[model samples]
Target: MSLLQTLPSLPSDAAYDLVVIGAGGAGLSAALHAAIDGAKVLVVERTAHVGGTTAWSAGTTWIPCTRHAKGVADEDSLERAARYLDRVVGDHADAALRRAFLAHGAEAVERFEQHSDVHYRPYALHPDYESDVDGSTLRGRALEPLPFDGRQLGALFGLLRPPIPEFTVLGGMMVDRTDINHLLSMGRSWPSLRHAVKIVARHAHDRLRHPRGTRLVMGNALVARLLHSLAQRPRVTLLMDTQMREIHVSDGHPGPGRSIEAVTLESAGTSRRIAVRGGLALASGGINRDPVWRERHLPGIPMDWCPGAPGHTGQAQALALQIGARHGQGAASPTFWAPVSRRQRADGSTAVFPHFVMDRAKPGMLTVNQAGRRYLNESMSYHRYGLAMQAEQCRSEAGEPGAAAALPSWIVCDAAALKRHGLGMVRPGGGGLAPFIADGYLRHGATLADLAHQLGMDAATLEATVATHNRHAEAGHDPDFQRGVTAYQRNIGDATWPGRNPNLGALTAGPYYAVQVVPGDIGAAVGLQTDDQARVLDAQGMPIGGLYAVGNDAQSIMGGTYPGPGITIGPGMVFGFLAARDAWRRCRSA
Candidate 1:
């Protein structure tokens, strides 16, 4: 969107030392470190801009044994971290790659913070996904990108991708963990009110000169820092709207002797061929949007409900597959799971929002099936929650909860919850419900039975479900699902409460509310199989030279388990750096 954009023109025969096929966190980190290590790098992106899924993420990096990990009063060592992973990840994890990651992860974090525009701070309160597991802590081991001023990019600031409009406030103004707290506490606290006012005023001024707020935070800040760092490097060239059309393999695409020679690309409606001297780093998110690949990899899951970036059609993965690269199979999940809510916007387009860290674990709410029974603990992480949703669907196929209502189940809540926690698009304090209700994104009724009727569920069954739920919730214990019992459950639960239970409260006050809930994914879990150094492995179990993968483009190191808040972003960056490093080493050795 900036008028000061510039694209370098390469000669018809010119080639770079390295070509990174995606501009997300992994790709950008690969480019930066590769350039720093003295490799001439060129990044080509399919979309008109950079910052693939990283721009739309929480930007938390869950690396073990980093300095910031210690800064948060949490003790983390290589052995302890490996033990934790062994317990959680089990046999599916590749020991070699896991060891490589643990050894180099701290260096990756430290190097970027020291030499690049990137910096991070560990969470003082954020806990591990498996907080109860050995070597896990309640307040460390994850790093978040420090907030960056987008104004530093000058005219090119607009080029950095923006966050989802639903995740933002006041139209397009970006906010973070602290900003949300301030906004939530506004009207009750003077400091919070002033903080909100300052942000509003800043956004208003920003709107006068820009299309959206410029105070980037979270994932946007991380992308901006990586982009800024890339811009500062003279040897790196980033080409947007350039897509690799075809790749030429030296040995005709199969066997252990296969190697890449060059790739044909289409840029700005013109085709260009560039010889690849080192290798291609594939980090184009995953197969969340590729209909064909989705059917092959993650069958039966609706692609429209997912919250991944539209550019993540798995082009990179497909290209590797065309070159005889084997797709990793038998992983925990073919894709990372999440709970997503879809709402049709005013412009006749549907908006998909990921339920990352809001509203689920709050008090006075519960998830139920059509037969009207609580299925799983509602306070668990979104990924685990999706697995639970799938389990309930499988269970529904067998017996009792007849009609299999849990797959497309409903999140049942009360007026107190609507006024306190807000469900998806329905804002807190019961505001903005009419429009959402008009669009049928939200449903409400004077009683639990009426709400269930609106949801096509058995009224009597739902009434019984809520009654039983209310009794146990009021007692601060969940006899059926055991909600709010773990550190993770209580961590996401509401801290400001009057009773002993923070994640539980009686849903007795009318009117009751219900929202349609379905399982969705964040990224592809199973990806191109790769070696310890991030080299793409063929079906014969041989590493493919001149070909590497990172992020969701490569099989997950944790085997798709949601170990922490920033697991996706963490390995993406680490293996990305490793991909470039290995490629450079190979080229030098040759």
Candidate 2:
């Protein structure tokens, strides 16, 4: 059944103690926890799907010192977590918000595990992005959503939002951290072969009854578990394809004078006003979809290649701004970024793939500017790669002769890397790559000089760059940027390679390939200013009653830095809990 079919019809004048706008991980979590606190809650989703961009994510939360991590041998404590935050964020992080996140983030995860069926599992080997930072550990800081059985939800499984199709294999069969390894080693290992066979059989069974594979995992699992938990809450209601048109103030004007009253909503072309007693939680994804705002904050970049969902166009930020909510300026870039490559699918539609992992960290691949000179440590996270791209662009502009072609970079790799790691959506070891080359989706040449000429890059410069890289790669060292030196880099690097340096394989194979790479953001970072309690604040730094912002909709408490995996959703979920509980307290007192 569709999500709308499962929803109850809205009453003519229905009201709720708390109204949550947007039904992603953060909004849904707020609604679920608020209902558990005995407050009547309603979730208004702009799209028919429940999960927003969170559904497109990896479902890992970079929350430190949770119950899931406490049992690990090298356990992380709140004190250490505080130290990490202080060093990573510096003056950018809000002192109060930082303290609050460390204090309540663990409790928030614990509360949900105790009261809801949704659960998280700690990664024993995953290290923080900045492994050298104080309080950083090699494990026990990142928590990923445990795999969920979609059969538990039954027909409601269709109501759960799906993950990015690019993340899946075998026609939409979702996989988790362990599942990927099992699938990758299918032919050589008996246990992997069995796992692959079981997955295929299950997907075949699901195809008979569903349009897409029903064996959900990863982000889909996270959303499904939350949906199931929310369904069990008697006081919670979810309405899909509902738009929050406008927000009304108590005095019929703006200025944050305790004026949050109600919201005007339009569903199926019919507008209705619903009163609110507690407050509104803004979790409408973020501003990645708004080009005007993107230009203002993140200049010289296009918003066409983002991985964010369709509905995150700064709706929540705009609504809050109507009542004098200040736009919080971040010390870091106004957005989180990733390098993206676009390809036309078989259906004639364009498919944009985010190079999140499995590409840059692999040996034999590197990125270069128009001059064919290498820049950056190619083994870092996608967020860092994006920043490096922009910084290179800026540096090129300052230098002479290289400024002409540095705005749009290119990812160059050898035949080995292309066959092993794959470029964008062109799978590794796949036979049919002629069409991709013919269509200009991929550029190839028989030799390095020929490839450089074809790509409009300097031939001598390209040759020198490869020679320098090969000299270092042969010895398992990267002198330029020290690639693969950090634990985080090596973890993402290829383990199958029997070499001293996992991320430093020389690109010396036959034919070389190059693909266009542009600066692309995964989501917006700058957003509404809020206090420690999550209440939206004004220009004067005063809390605006009845207004709270969480997730990407608010200025990231990480101070615009991507600390680790799930940084976006983890704090979003925590603050969502804080916002809902605060609303419960205010409503109960009333």
Report the Cα lDDT for residue 354, model 2.
82
Model 1 per-residue lDDT tens digits across residues 1-590: 22222243676776777888888888999988898788888888888767887898888888888888776655668888888888878777687788889899999988898889999998778877787899776766778899998998986686788788888888799988789888889989999999999999999999999889988889999999998888877888777777888887886666668887788888667888888888888888877899887787666678887887778887778878887898876677777888778888878877887766667778888888767778788888899998888888877777753436576778878988888888876767787687888878888889887887798877887888788888887788887778888787888888887767788888878898888878888888888999888999988889887899898899898887888888888888889888888879867886
lDDT of each: 0.82, 0.82
* lDDT of model number 2: 0.82
Residue 67 of candidate 2: its Cα lDDT?
76
Residue-level error in angstroms, candidate 2, position 491? 0.9
User: Which residue pairs in candidate 1 collide?
Assistant: 335-525
TM-score for each model: 0.96, 0.96
- Candidate 2 Cα misplacement greater than 4 A, ranges: 1-8, 400-404
Rate residue 313 of model 1 by lDDT: 87
